[model samples]
Target: MTGAMVTGAPETTGYGGTLAAEAARFAALGWMRGTSGNLSVVTGRDPVRLLVTASGLDKGELRPGDMVLVDEEGTAVPGATAAGKPSAEAALHARVVRLTGAGAVVHVHTVASVAMGRRRPGGIAFRDLEMLKGLGRSAHDEEVVLPVIRNSQDMSVLGDRLEAALDPGVPAVVVAGHGLYAWGADLREARRHTEVVEWLLELQLAEERGR
Candidate 1:
């Protein structure tokens, strides 16, 4: 697919196609089953344009037409064929991108992540794990704290709180009772972060259960 144009208006097709591909890959992994996740890619820099998954579509069946183009304020731009309204957490995605200057944001409801978020004290810790290096940590000895924010239906309020709690160096955060939100300079890095975090959560859960 061609790179998205940086025009202030929506490059709906380009962004939508990218989201669809990523969504399908995540869905196949069961990380976003039954419309439980959303993905977005920044299509423009100036004025900040984004293409994100629309609400209520089955993630496993996501199509290029199943996405919507929105401005920085989360409003749907005119003339773009949006599949439906943008995801309820669109504001959260916008906040992350605005704060981190990330190119893409991905959220998923993996079983391991949900369980770990529920049981983790304060936050999940990845220490002495080789996977920690995947997240830009220089060494396995480093302790990386993945911030865990409380979940709420009031996304505006939640988004505000999350933005306040974010640590610029961290690439991902977990929402209590919800799921994981991860981002990176591009989709591959973002997805890799998600995979590493999910794996760490599973390992932590297993260790706790054995105790």
Candidate 2:
């Protein structure tokens, strides 16, 4: 947030190492199996340039150089240094950042998220849970409906639906039949939000099964 938004691609990606580490952690949890998920960090604001994890590489084995610089449209910056291609979902990630001003984004394929996306495609409501505070919501007597948007192969289509379904108060969104996307002021906060939302979704699924 300190430097001005550079109009061109940055020569060095200062966040690659951190993002690689985070991606490995998520991969270890089985939330980012194979190359199924991606992590991104905002490098600029006004123009919204970000460093996103490269596509088709095992998230668990990502190196510091395994990333690509992309613009708001998810197109790789022409002169950006990159070890691989940008993830297919980069556009949606950019959309989230543009809409929310989030500093970082985490996308993962968690079982709980996929299940809830299918079970509650419209949306899933959470209430009266202490964990709600983790998502910046009141702990008690509060209801939060996490948006669930249908998935699409085209990032534009997916981004459109996500824009319509987004809850400004909610930092996370579930892609029905696909996965979860979470964001925050930074990578740490984004990761925390991702974990909290996933946990809440798991609890919701359990409650439904018990009833």
Best by TM-score: 2
How much is 133 displaced in model 1, in angstroms? 0.6
CA lDDT, every model vs. true structure: 0.80, 0.88
> Candidate 2 lDDT, tens digit per residue, 1-211?
3145434333343577888899999999999986899999888876778888999999999887888888988888876764768987999889888889899999999989999999998999999999999999998888999999999999999999999998999999999999999999999999999999999999999989899
For every model shown, the clashing-pair count is: 0, 0
Per-residue lDDT of model 1, residues 1-211, tens digit only? 2256434323334566667888989999989987888988887777787788889989888777787777787667776654679987887888788889888899999877778888873788778888778788855667788888888898788888788778777788889888999999888788888887788788888998899
Best by lDDT: 2
